[model samples]
Target chain A: MSPQHRALATREAILRAAAEEFDRLGYDAAPLSAILERSGVTKGAFYFHFPSKEALASAIVQVQDDTWPRLTGQWRDRGLDPLRTLIGLFEEAVSLLSRDVVLRAGVRLAADRDVGYPGLSSAHLRWEKVLGDLLLAARDAGQLRPGVDPEAAARTLTSAALGARLISSATCRCADFPERMREVWRLVLPGLATDEWCPPALEVLAAPQEP
Target chain B: MSPQHRALATREAILRAAAEEFDRLGYDAAPLSAILERSGVTKGAFYFHFPSKEALASAIVQVQDDTWPRLTGQWRDRGLDPLRTLIGLFEEAVSLLSRDVVLRAGVRLAADRDVGYPGLSSAHLRWEKVLGDLLLAARDAGQLRPGVDPEAAARTLTSAALGARLISSATCRCADFPERMREVWRLVLPGLATDEWCPPALEVLAAPQEP
Candidate 1:
């Protein structure tokens, strides 16, 4: 590997180990010594990548934030309609949350009141905005129910998705995330989408997709 | 005041102040000294009531658990049907969560990955059970739509309600709880309830209550 590539690899190692520590313990309890030990990286290398535990936390959240837009952009490029894009976006999130430790840790840290990283809650607001914009497009495209409030629907769906993560992880360690999200969209789409769009949206959510 | 009354008051004071500190600073950051200063109780008196900070955390969660049953029983005694009963319960919870610091602290602690207290997650499981049983009763009473999964619906609603709390507090410190919950039920009930009951449940959720 090139010098820069090796450096990137070391940083990834530290981040993976740190995310595991944070995911297993929380921000308050996850110590730097353990992260370094688990990563098998020297103290100098660890400090070179992350100055503090909070910095590691910010890195994990940054990874998740970057993942969201990229995934959404990919789905958007598929030419799916707005309502379908929302469904596709949620499906991708549920799948990623189940497998990605860094993503799960980012989510856990965001909800955790202990983590003081300033950038944490912004992810949630960004997500709500993303959902809102999609719902607005869905409405304008004649896909949403006539009385559905886009802003309220956006926040409600965002909250539900967030809650789905919390309950799923707290209980089954996120093994049930996809099923939980499927149930959320099953109920929500029926009320939020127009008659024509609701059934098809439900069908898409009910149908399984390749990860 | 009588000696017994004085002791009770002191304990209540410690609990209130501790809950305030926990609510503001989270579990790890909330110091007993700040709680003591805020409660205006001596260290000796504080120890007399709560053996440790974990005990204080337990007391807050206990208060919330006790309130759930009492509030639910009161609503049940009003002879509400199963579906309406669920609506009434969630509405009360939303209102209570907005103003009750102890209750909010319990919720915060329950979701906090840092808190090691064993009792925190039982509240969530208990809540899921309560919602499940109610949905089951509603199904048995022919109040549900065809093809609705009661267990999934139960878990879905619990997750959504839990999510509403997290988002509300994260953004607006829970002033938006009522509005958040209203949007939740508005989106959830239409898909979960039968044609006859869905509209009325939405009405109850939408109409302002006496609280």
Candidate 2:
């Protein structure tokens, strides 16, 4: 492998190890020494990449953002109908959160630990704004129902999605978090759905029956 | 005041001050010296009431639980028909959260921090059972539709409520957390609602906008 490729691989390895440590022990209790030991990397290399644990946290948040399709790009590409994109994005998010433990942990931590962290908050707001702008764009297109507050509705939907994940992960015994999530979304999405799309048939999505 | 009254007053004062300090600075960062100053008590008295900060934290959680009406009583009273009651509880919780920053912070901290702390998880589970039992009762009464997993659904609702608080607090300015909570409950309740009531109608009961 090229020198650049080797460096990238080492960085990704450190981040994966850090994510596991942070998730298992939490942000405060997780120590750099433990991460170094787990990653099998020397202290010098870890410090070279991340000056502090908080900096490493920022890196993790960035990685999470990069892994998903950017909300802005996704919405904008939907041909001026942002609401369609917004729903699609949430559907995608539910899928990602259901399938990936790292994503779920990262999201929960984002809600809990990163509220006080500026870099994380900024990235979070940027994402929220992308959603907010989509709402605004939909409003401009006359797709939203009358009297809807674009920003407020957007935040409400965003918050509900986060809430769905929290519910599924902490409480559900079901193996796929997404399975539970779609049900929560069905209840949540109708209120936010634009006048253009007929409400998806409100079905009673249920748990798999035992043998 | 009598001597006994004075002593009791001092202890309560210390606990109130300790709660504020602990909530703001967390267990490790909150110094007893500051709490002592806030309560105007000597270190001897502070140590007399509480041996360590951990003890103080435990006391604070206990005091809050006593003061707060968790879902337990609500679930019991509305046992056979809990869909509306559970939704009503979230509505009440959201309004209460708006007025009390301490409660909001404390609850979120309890959810995140208590997993490692002894006794807390058990207490949390006990609360969960209260909610679970209510859901089971509702199922037997035909409130929850067929194929709805009572335990899983109850946990999902609880987790969503916690996550909603986190999101609301995290983005306090962008959204009114209380109102958004109503929106969340609106979505969650319908799936669990009986055939006669539609979800939006519950919103009118919980949060009727002025004419």
Candidate 3:
């Protein structure tokens, strides 16, 4: 590989291993030595890439930002109905957060102490806007139930989804996250979406790949 | 002072100081020395009250259990309707959690990488049962809307409140927790409770002291 490519690979290696340490041990408890050993990178190489433990953590959080918009764009491209896309996005976000070590570490670090609240983050805003925009589209298409305020629905959806993620993590270590989310959506959709729209959306959420 | 009384006072001091340390700096980050200094106790005195930092944490968590029942009973005595009582409980729980250092420490420790999920705790079960029983009572009283599942409502309320607490902690350090809970209830109540019941409950939640 070219020198530039090798440099990129080295950076990625450090991040992956560091995320594992942080996700397993938490930011305060995570050991820099463990990260370096896990990454199989030399001390000089590690220092060249990340000057401190905090720097490595910041990168993981930065990568999380990069991941979100791409995933949001990909799901939107499927051309499914808007609320359907919204449900699909919720399910997929939970799934990714459950299994993806890097993303999980980013989320955990982002939560530690307020540099800021995730609610106030651009990502939070972006996430809310994504849900909000979808709800607006659903409303325009008459997919929402009568008198449903799309903005409230969007904020509720975002907050509820955030709550479900933490709740599942705290309750079952995310073992039953998809199931927990399905239950939440079941109640939320009937309240927020039109009668005709909710049933199929629930069906699709229960089994996203079945066409 | 009586020897036994002084011992109890000493124990309270240690727990209070330790909770401040733990809440300020998470479990792994909190220093034993600072807890000792802040409590104004010697190491021997501190150990006499609590064997270890984890013990202090355990005691704090245990103390939390004691606090819950007393608070629950006190609120129940107010003789409000089931739904209002429910909203009152959420608001109070969030309010207590926001400012009570001991409760904050217990909650933070409870969420660490896990001996278990808070959801599986007896406290979680009790919390769920409390909400569930209230919802069932509401349904029987015709305060709940048609087709609202008391069991699901109970679980959802429990999860959502748990979520709201964590979300607020992560987002704003709980500065606007009351406002956040109010927003969540606004979206939630309409779905689960009668329209007439919801407005007044929301009003009470917005200002709990007013008649």
- Fnat for every candidate: 0.49, 0.24, 0.25
lDDT of 1 at A27: 72
> DockQ score for model 1, please?
0.45
**Clashing pairs for predicted structure model 1, backbone only:** none
lDDT of 3: 0.75
Q: Is the docking of candidate 3 incorrect, acceptable, medium or high quality?
A: acceptable
lDDT of model 3, residue A100: 77
**Candidate 1 Cα misplacement greater than 4 A, ranges:** A1-11, A33-55, A110-120, B1-7, B41-54, B110-120
- Model 1: per-residue Cα lDDT over A1-211, one tens digit each: 9999999999989988988887766676788889899999999888888888888888887787688889989988999899999888889888988888888887667645434321135677788898999899999999988888998998888877777776676566677889888888887777898888888888887676666
Whose lDDT is greatest here?
Answer: 1
Off by over 4 Å in 3: A1-65, A75-85, A95-156, A170-175, A189-211, B1-11, B41-48, B76-79, B116-122, B208-211
Model 2 C-alpha lDDT per residue in residues A1-211, reported as the tens digit of each score = 9989877887877887887776555667788889888888888888878899888877776656676656446645767456666666655666665655466546545544543411123444555677788779777876666656777665555554454444445454114556555555554444455535425323323333222
How large is the i-RMS for each model, in angstroms?
4.2, 5.6, 4.4
Please say which candidate is ahead in DockQ: 2 or 3.
2
Candidate 1 local lDDT, B1-211, one digit each (tens): 9999999999888988988888766676798889999999888999999899988988887787789889878887888899999888888888999988888887776545434321135576788898899899999999999988888888788877777776677566678888888888887888899899998888887687655
Error of 2 at B16 (Å): 1.8
Winner of 1 and 3 under DockQ: 1
Find the 10 residues in a row with the least total lDDT in model 1 chain A: A111-120
Ranking by lDDT: 1, 3, 2
TM-scores of the candidates are 0.88, 0.74, 0.70
